[model samples]
Target: MLFVAGSTVLGGASARAAEQADETSTAESSPIIVTASPLPVRLDELAAPVLRLDREDIEASQASTLGALLADQPGLSESSFAAGASRPIIRGMDNNRVRVQENGIGAGGVSALSEDHGVPIDPLSATSVEVVRGPATLRYGSEAIGGVVNVLNDRIPSARPSGGYSVSGGTSFDTVDQGKEAHGALNVATGNIVWHADGFRRETSDYDTPQGEQFNSWTDTSGVSGGGSVLFGNGYAGANVVHYDSEYGIPAPEDPADPVHIDMRQTKVQLRGAFAFDSWLRGIDFAGGYGDYRHDEITQSGVVGSTFKNKEWEGRAEFQHGAVGPFAGAFGVQYRDRDLSAAGEGGELLAPNTTRAVAGFLYEEMSLTDALSLQMAGRVEHVKVEGTALDTATITEYDVSRDFTPLSASAGLVWNLDGGWVTSATFQAAQRAPEAPELFSKGPHEATETFEIGDASLNEETAYSAELSARREGRGYSFAASLFHVSFDDFIYKALTGETCDDDYASCTDAGGTGTELDQVRYAQQDARFYGFELEGKVALLRTDTATYGVTGQADYVRAKLDGGTNVPRIPPMRIGAGVYLEADRFMAKAGFLHAFRQNKLGPNETETGEYTDVSMAFRYTLPEQMTGGASVKISVVGQNLLDADIRNHVSFKKNDVLLPGRNFRLVASVDF
Candidate 1:
């Protein structure tokens, strides 16, 4: 059975009839909804490729960060320099080019400003996650030109439970880091009223590597959320509140004698509503949120060295429409306002700034034939930033204001061929304004150990891209492949200036820098291009009445370069992997081997990374029923990097100074009541 929101395509007529019945009965028995999209569209019908991580997937991975959760996916890699802080690199693009969201709303954090800052969302508390690479740029913003990662927690009660109440809980432990995690969720409904509550906590010691333990690699995370809603005849409305807090160490090279840590906290409130209609418009959906986030960098002496804060409010509204002469789609409006500031020792890196943005978008899909369809989306936005910059040395202050109008559009065509084969082609053009850090930063960043300078004259970056994908799904075999290329005009990047500076911005004359050996870097613009290919397939080897076995293989590679012949920095190496799996009524197991090819294509002042391979295995077993509603307890064991080989992520800035985690093992258990 193929399960998707709005539409479910099953293998047989009986299966189709069963799905229809479930859709009308309870949401738990129905297909998962695609909340990331403006209009409710089936996953398979989407013009662009999407990667989804369900609750089961998240539980099995035992990932500590969003970057680690997606690092293994094709065309994706983790910054991986530090265990406590890392961001996803999509299709060779990272930083501001990628957008992180919680339930389709901006994270309202400063993770994009620097590599050491961690994303505030807690993956352990999420119900599902969705990744989109193309069309998301139109609906969300130009920052999604690289991709979008939407974490769906369902904090706001969207629907009522079939019964009076439902409860779920899980716990896990990892050997590599001596880590422990636990989470629980509850949902109760009475008549037209529904309520929800969830909480999660995680703690870990410094992780162990093949050589020894990585210093300052510990993490502590916790979060709680509560919400309630009223179900009206027309639709449902709800509001939610969430609190998240985390404190983690920032591992440093052997050179640094003192240790660093980050203390962070966030409080967020969200309101959502949806209404069904009987007119040309199908329904209206709206969501709005406000967030207050703050973080402090602590030194070994127990003093707070630097502090950062972000206060933001964001909202979106969209109206779904029925088919009208082969046209069906949704139009929406979005607004966001953020005030960001920094203080203390490292405050000079970025001036306090406030940004405001307003946008309108339209998306439409037309069915040209039984097997052919076209999708197009466009967005226009106005953005403004206000700040004040002061020259401390000269005791002079200056007013800073910048404004931009960014536009983005995308078109795609999907053709359903015979024999369950499908193909899609997409082209997109997107523009993104320079972020505050890229436009105004003027001092040292202690976390990244870099002396940074920004360019106020930088213009908005623009990208044009095209992609072609093909897939064939069968009963015993399946395969997918895609090729993509992108060209950028005025790509903004940090370039090394071949100058070194101490923490006080004083010239460092010693070869072995004592205070801080940080190179000076300046934001610059250049014409660049990136291209990649990804392929994945699975084939069944044996099948029986109650058991089946299969083999899977996947490979992906990306290349990037500038127009003037310099290679892009920190590009992920090419990777190929294979795995085998067996499934039965009560047990399931899988094993895999992954190889990362050596990367010799070096950027200016960059070093090459050696190749490495990893071995991983996992298995799960369902015990006898122990709860109501056919809910059975399940236990899972997972192993990663079983080889214990030394590994380095080519995309990581600290690859040469630090090694990736060694062999790891995890035991997880979950139950529903």
Candidate 2:
């Protein structure tokens, strides 16, 4: 059954409604800025759903990773191996399907391949985070079919002498782990030349859990970044470079018989430059970047391995001219090349792979009328993959090559109505090619206790999605609701056929042949569908000289089907949450509770996960007098599984054996200068 529910309000209608609700309300309203264009545009004018996490919001959340912070936002989910490893899921899609962008460019690292790996960029360093919930096909490549999460930092050398330094030291109660970090950035300007430099180092000890104490786990990370620019008559040109390294791992239990242990390390380097033109081709911009990354992992199964290297190069050019009526457009081309090689023990090459992609796109935003606008975009990408397949039997390999061409497009309309109401509707068609691991993996997945498999004949997956939203903004109260549906063909999934090896373990075998049992894993394609609704709003309750307070509420429900069947694995359940925030000029506090609905409907091969709830609180304040040039202190307390609920994330692969973190507490403190 296809379900669609929601009422659409015209653009600017919410603002009118809010004005009608209150005449004395002084709530400041502003449009969100998005990097989806060569030139930024206001979110309300972009004709898509874009969530902006401003600097104040980031400081208030006190999250450790970008994935963790984004999880609580609408249309986002999180999958975590531990506190140190968490990946973000967007609209029921994850892994390579979602693109993580840094200042409109790719992160160019191993984060796209594995779940346990962390994003190399630091979340605290970002000035803001933007989550583009609609098709970003015009700005990014085919991989961004799901959406784009851009982390913007101060990478560009500022032409002003302004910068700050921060130092923080804290400890975790639940993990009994202590950590310290320091970061400093300086920007100097002289005549037409600007120089900037920043560096940071962070270290942490092993962590402990309520179940027991985990050992051998520690984290050490250090990085330095610098850039310089020269202002000229035509434009400003700049060059930037960054080098980073980190070593971290998950420890085994103290029982000494545990077989699960992971030790991982990574190092990355990037160089980039950009230029803007003023003469001849006015409003034209160009930029290019190069990146190299290396990773190594050591497991307890004697499968010591290392990935030697992967390099990426990308270039883009765009033109923008707004004086041409209410119609503005930008078009550009991008190219990326990635090469990777891996080796096991004895310095033996497991498999070597290389991929190249080229794409071109155009985006146009037109103001159809005074209150109505339209956004149209389209992109085409050509990707080629080539590599040498390892033949374990004869110790010989054969060459493999494949190419794919996919096209994506999107259209959206925004209507501005009176009475503080705003409405938008969007339709998008996108496709994604298979990732490297999905096409070539052949080994044991010790973590899941299963033999892994892959097929080189896999094809691209395609999807079509549509969404409608309505929002009303008011001084005393506000509300917004959205309904969305997405359908996919050739959706890739892992299936279990109720077959096992004689060794009493899961294994794949030739059922029609001589009954020879091998590994127990294969990637298959299936038709899939997802539909859901999300609603969120806030209300200002009280205002006074000493204190101001507000209430916020949000709810989400999603359902997915595979091959027209009711069973779909790894789907999150309906959730509802509410919170209150109180603040003074220099002090602020927040408390909230989250409830997750039970998931009883399971696929023939699915497991059931019970329902649960949790509560959390935080507080922050500024010092009376300046200890240094500038000073502030922040403290927060978070209690996971506050109800002591024996709950597990329904979407987790480890749901059968592991439980979410039990009742635990975490406290944090930081200072800025």
Candidate 3:
């Protein structure tokens, strides 16, 4: 039997809905810039659901990592592997299914391979973020079968400066780990040329948890970016270079006395261009990037135990066209190449690998009537994977190559109702080829503390997903809600074989345990089902000449199970929250309570997690120009887990040993000139 709750207004395009006015309001429901879709239409014009986190919300959150900043949002959860390493889990799907990209390019990091690794992209580097679901995945690729989290970086200038020159900077501090960060950006536009530069540095000490302290959870990171663009009469072209470095530690439950840490570096170069024409073809846009990344895992003795490296490049081109015979659409092509390798201890897990892929996608929309539209899209990808396949049976490695052609398609319907109300339904059938790690891994991984194994005979994974959502954009009251379900065939996942093993694979099944510290897990496939719903909205309770008071609330739930009546491991439990806010000219504040219910649904060898409530607060004030030498300045105070709750992330691999950070007070001050 299946269970689903009923709600009339549970989900919608929140980005297109009303602003809460927590830190003041948007320019009266300003149109959001949408990028996930092939067409440059408003949120309502797209069939899938989109949730955006704007600049104001980032300032209020004052979170350093991308996962920490967006974890509390509806339909989203974090792995919370450590204070420094965390990744978002969308509707119980994570890792390979979710694509975390910067300006349409992959992060080019190894974070997706393991939860203990950090996503190199920082929250401070992005001006906004979009969490897109449903048909939007067709535009990215098969890897985005779950969804796409697109980070809009400020490294490249999209528009000219306000007054020929502009500068902005900010500094933040938090008490949880005594974290401190400073960031600055400068943009100058003269004539048709625009230049941009930005840099940031962040450092944190081991964070305090409800239980004394998390011994090895701290992070030190810095990055710098510079770019320039030449504006044409109809479009613009730009290029940017970014360099990043970071060192972070994870929980050491396996070896608490001698914790392991990682040091990583990445350099990326990107080029983007857009052209508008006066023909049936409306415009052409292009994006390309090259990234060289590497990381070293160091033991407590300060010796590098393993090294991972990746050099990759990707490029995409899009062609937009106007209506033709009652239909309008866009078509595009994309190409990606990656070369990755592991050495030292990591070499036992996987050998050198290379992957190349090319895909072509197109989407078309037809207006059935004035208030209704039909959208359809399709994509076909050709992928070639080359690597050394490990034969667990023969205890030998052999070079192997495989090729696959995965296809995907989607269809959606949008209905426009009266009074700023809109609803949409989208369905997609997508397939994903086996990633390098899934098909070639073997041996013990000290970072995750798992003796992993893989099979080279794995096939493509496929899923059929659907979403239904509605939204209302209003000043006094607004709301959005969504219901989604995804069914998978041949779902590839890592599961323990109810056994333990040592560092050597031969001992894994020898009836005796050598390194009993490591759990034995293998890559396998199974039929699975997932379904979830999300609800979020805000309503004005009181309105006065000086300020407006509003009440806000949100709730989300997801459930997944295998065909054999077994629960899915690491699935987030139901969460419900509510809050109140005040918005004025110079002052704004919000207080909220978010609670996670107890989770009892257990997978094999999985433990239960207790319930917890998080009390949070945010306040912001704008200073007068006279006080800051004509520079616009804003100060914000943000608090998280104010009640100091003892919380464990159900989605985390280390949930049994690690606790979420306790009470935290964050202060942010930014200035613009």
Point to the candidate with the largest lDDT: 3
Task: Give me candidate 2's TM-score against the actual structure.
Answer: 0.83
Q: Would you estimate the TM-scores of all the predictions?
A: 0.93, 0.83, 0.94
- The sequence of per-residue lDDT tens digits that candidate 1 reaches over residues 1-673 is 0011001121101112212222222333234444435555554566776777767778877577888888887788899757767888898899899999886788888889888888889788777776876664577777888988878765765566656676778999999999999998888877777788899999999888888998888899999999987777667778999998989888864335777789989999989777767778777777889999999988777878789999999999877788877888888999999999999755777778888999999888888888898988999999897776534344354678999998999998989888888888999999998888888777777777787777777899999999999887778887888999999999998886666777544343233444446777778899999999988777889999998899888889999998888998899999998888888998988888888999998778888999999888888998877443577578999898999988889998888877888898989998766
**Count of backbone collisions within predicted model 2:** 16
Clashes of each: 0, 16, 7
Cα distance off (Å), candidate 1, residue 85 = 1.4
Model 3 lowest lDDT segment of ten: 1-10
Better candidate number, 1 or 3, judged by TM-score: 3
Please estimate how well model 3 matches the true structure, expressed as its whole-model Cα lDDT: 0.80
Candidate 1's C-alpha runs over 4 A off are 1-30, 253-256, 388-397, 504-516, 626-629
Q: What is the lDDT for 347 in model 1?
A: 76
Best by TM-score: 3
